[model samples]
Target: MPAYQLYVYEDQEKREALEQKICEQVDACTEVNGKIRNRVKKFLIEEGITDISEMNAALRVRYEGYLERNETVHVPITCLRGFDRIFLHRMKEELKTLAGQRKYTTEYRDQWLCLTHYPDVEVAESFLTSKDGKELVWNFTLECPRKLKMQIFTVLKEVIHTYEGWTRKEKLLALQRLYQFCVVNQVSDIETMTLEEEQKFALKLSEDLGEKKKNAVFGILRMSRKILFLQAPEINWNANVWFLERFHFSKERINPSKPVELVSFKEVTNLENQKILQKYLRYLFGITDLCISTIRIKLLELRTFLVYFNGEEKPIYEVEAEKIQRYLESIQRQDTREKTANGRIFMILQFYNFLVVKRYLKKIPFRYEYYLQKEVHVHNDRSVPEGVYTEILSKLAEFPEHLRLMFLHLWCTGIRGSEVCTLTGDGYEEKDGDYWLKVYQVKMKTYKRIPIPEALYKLVQVYKKKYQIGPEEYLFQNQTGGAFRYGTFRYQMLKYCEKYQIANGEYIFKSHDYRHNLATLYYDSGISLQAVRDYLGHEYEEMTRQYVDYMPKKLEKASEAYFQEETHSFAAELMKGEFHG
Candidate 1:
């Protein structure tokens, strides 16, 4: 490492002394005119870039006026574009500022940042002066050919090692291997490649390699740009949803099933739209604690809108209401569900609101505010009938202990499908004589404790005692004593349904429907609306009532007066003709 001195400036005398050192190096070279050389020299002097030294590896220069005293590094040459071709880069302001002067090209970048794929030295020399715009220059060196990969591997490895994940080192090595495969297959410029071509290449690679190896390839290829974004200050991080999965499987850490769709800022195409989206996304990620699953949804919304209008390649903020209406109509044709199509319109309204608030648009250009409410009426089919629950529970008694405990817990607690698997022993706590089940709702990102009634509370106590569960152990673990898995839960439910000849039509009763059953039972037991909301972790009163909204008008009033004292007999209230005909 080169030693650095701050050159703490006190007065003009010290500054002049530092300026003379740079002048001496310029004075040594006699190829240029004094006036022309001084003109270039004046820009450097005004910019405070005079500090220069000839290191063993390369000549070093640090400008003044910069806080760090080490920014604005320039070429070793007396002039900007002179031969000896000392890679001049790191423009102070915008690329347009330099482009207007004709002093800099559009491709201006630091020599260290550029990784050329071309093997010819002549072509490489042409790229230093930027004469040959033909040479493919990857921002990440690992994407370059063998020699360049060897040069960058160590630096990139050190950077990758700084990330929090255990797979950081493996990701780096895998990226290198993938890059080499790309290079060998003549994929010199991925950014310029058409989407179809890229997909074909991926397909070819998958066919050549086995499925396992192809998946490994996708993992590395998908992560390649994200790793570069973390390391490179020049290249920015764009949160583009690859496929934007229809659902988030919490087991997969909410990541999409596939991440290699070649979706990026390149999809936006319009430079202004790219800038607005970049700013918006950066602001959102910085301010919001939204889960990765939610973030992907937002990213996909932006991507879909952008791609919809990409044919014209106009800036997205320039959109009019007619275009929005047309887009909505188009989406209606594509999506079969009215609710799904209307949800797209709802998101677009919010997106328009974002643009106006962020000052990306002059005013709200969309006239679809009145159409925002899409009458998305959902049927009250997400619950098992009282007769159905009685049959299921009686049949469940014959199953294994783990299977019985899982269903009974969800039934009594009204917990979501995945939440049942994630419950910890510490989640169960005694307050006075009452035991509370601590629930951490992943979607709402909040925690609440629901009081355990006598029968279920006793069951939890007996279950914990029988398993010899510690405070940190899972409240409901598997037979192997590990956390319960959703896949295993579904499998067990399917087998139970098959053996008992139970089915809710073609669909077996889902774990979520048990939550519906709990909500109905609570309302029937005259539990307060506020209490139901608190137990379910719902933020709004309206959401809490959604469970009971489907009941008959008479039943709604009747249920409030009805309370089963035994708690376990709450289902019997539902079995009466008021709930089941």
Candidate 2:
């Protein structure tokens, strides 16, 4: 009823002699006759008679019905060698063809038989074989062990064959099938098989010759299957094998000729030794896409290097520098935009030095020294009057209740519009008689607690009551009852400003501009630069100083007088001129 099973048996010398006789007859046949020759051969071999001429006499004396039924025919080893060699040789050829076609490579040898490529041995006395194989070898006085089942050695072999020359994804699937077979079959002691056994197994499965002549064949098959199944497509199986062979299998010689190359941003792109140039454009000037129109020339130069040096062994740093200089010279000859070119070159030089310090490159190229320049900080020229805030607040009153509160929150706390949109009930906290919202600034990588003004707090209460605020709800939920994204919030703010005609129609401001406005206001209110910096959570005082220049002249004068102990009238005079209260 089952698809297949295994059988073990114990056979003494008599049974062994009979099986050997049958094997000899099979081996001697050059071409098989009809059933008569088969019957005669079986009888002579099983009865242990040496000659077919003596078969009748020996069978009649020993047992009856020897010729009556085919199963009754049994031969002995002594009689097998004496059988016609032509008939025996044919039988052997037939058996070998059958085994090969069925993917069975095992062969019988004398009384003791060795399975092809399989580690297990079947002796004359205690022979363990699969059920089907046993059926073919029955009538030899051998018995099957009830519990033993057929072991499909062919499954592993076939898997190994299938994985060869397969693509990464295909190899992975093949390995999965192999593992499933092992788990399902409960195969154990795979390592016990000798090199002969493994080779035999491989020969049985497929005709292709594997690289490893002996024992390593099995290991290589297993490893390759696993790699194909478990690792990503980008991961190189051959490279991994080479690494393992070099390190783990020290004695084994594996030399891979064409190794994969690792490319960098610049190497892939082909910019000259302009490390500083690239860095400045990318980081300082905020030009993110070097391959775009902004830096097309540099990108083209990098592309040329990649093509010219294709498959060549060259240090990436050197290649990058050479390509960058070529581009620079080309731009100079053409009388292109000198300012932009110089800026790029300078940044590249700085970036080169940085890479050297990080040990990514060995040496800073000589051209870097010529391009190095000290960085300068420029002041913004935008200025706003004190009345501008009041005017914006009045325009915000014309919008919906929630919009009004959102504007007030942004203006009062100096938080970004996106942060305001993302605010939820959980962000609000009360501590030491002060209420504040915890702002998660992604770029800053820290949470900021911005104090809520009284006016804004009252407005929030009104907004919450109107919306029937829930505990886990966003404070500024959109139509989907979820927090608004940055783009949506910005759009809404711009729309409101347009509709209200606020700040002389110059009410356009980014979410970040609020922080700048707050910093300026804080400095004008006579707060110490350090105090303002702490409140804003700025790492450097220089960043906070950007707002200092924007402070009202009156406040600036007051600060100067306070520090220098000059005339107090200086503050009054400066305020009269600068303040439009």
What are the lDDT figures for the candidates, one per model?
0.56, 0.48
Global Cα lDDT for candidate 2: 0.48
lDDT tens digits, residue span 2-41, model 1: 2333334344667787678666655444555565445445
- The numbered model that scores best in TM-score is 1
Clashes within 3 Å, all models in order: 1, 46
Candidate 2's residue-wise lDDT over 1-581, tens digit each?
33332222334555666667665654455344444445555555666665432322123323334332435345432122222233233333443565433432332212221111122112211212222221112111113211111122233333333433223223333333333333444433232222333445566334433444333333444553333323323433222111222122111111111111111132332223333333433342232322122233444444443445444444446566666566556544554355555665654555566668657778865464454344445556343445766777766667776667777776788776666776767777667878877776533546788788766666676677788887677788777786756566677778877777777567775666777778888877889899888777788987777756565566567677785754446576586674555
lDDT of candidate 1 at residue 193, scale 0 to 100: 32
Error of 2 at 257 (Å): 50
Please give the TM-score that candidate 1 achieves against the real structure. Answer: 0.55
- TM-scores, each model vs. reference: 0.55, 0.39
Show model 2 residue runs off by greater than 4 Å.
1-361, 366-372, 381-383, 462-473, 477-483, 504-506, 549-581
User: The CA-based lDDT of model 1 is what?
Assistant: 0.56
Which candidate should be chosen as best, given lDDT against the real structure? Answer: 1
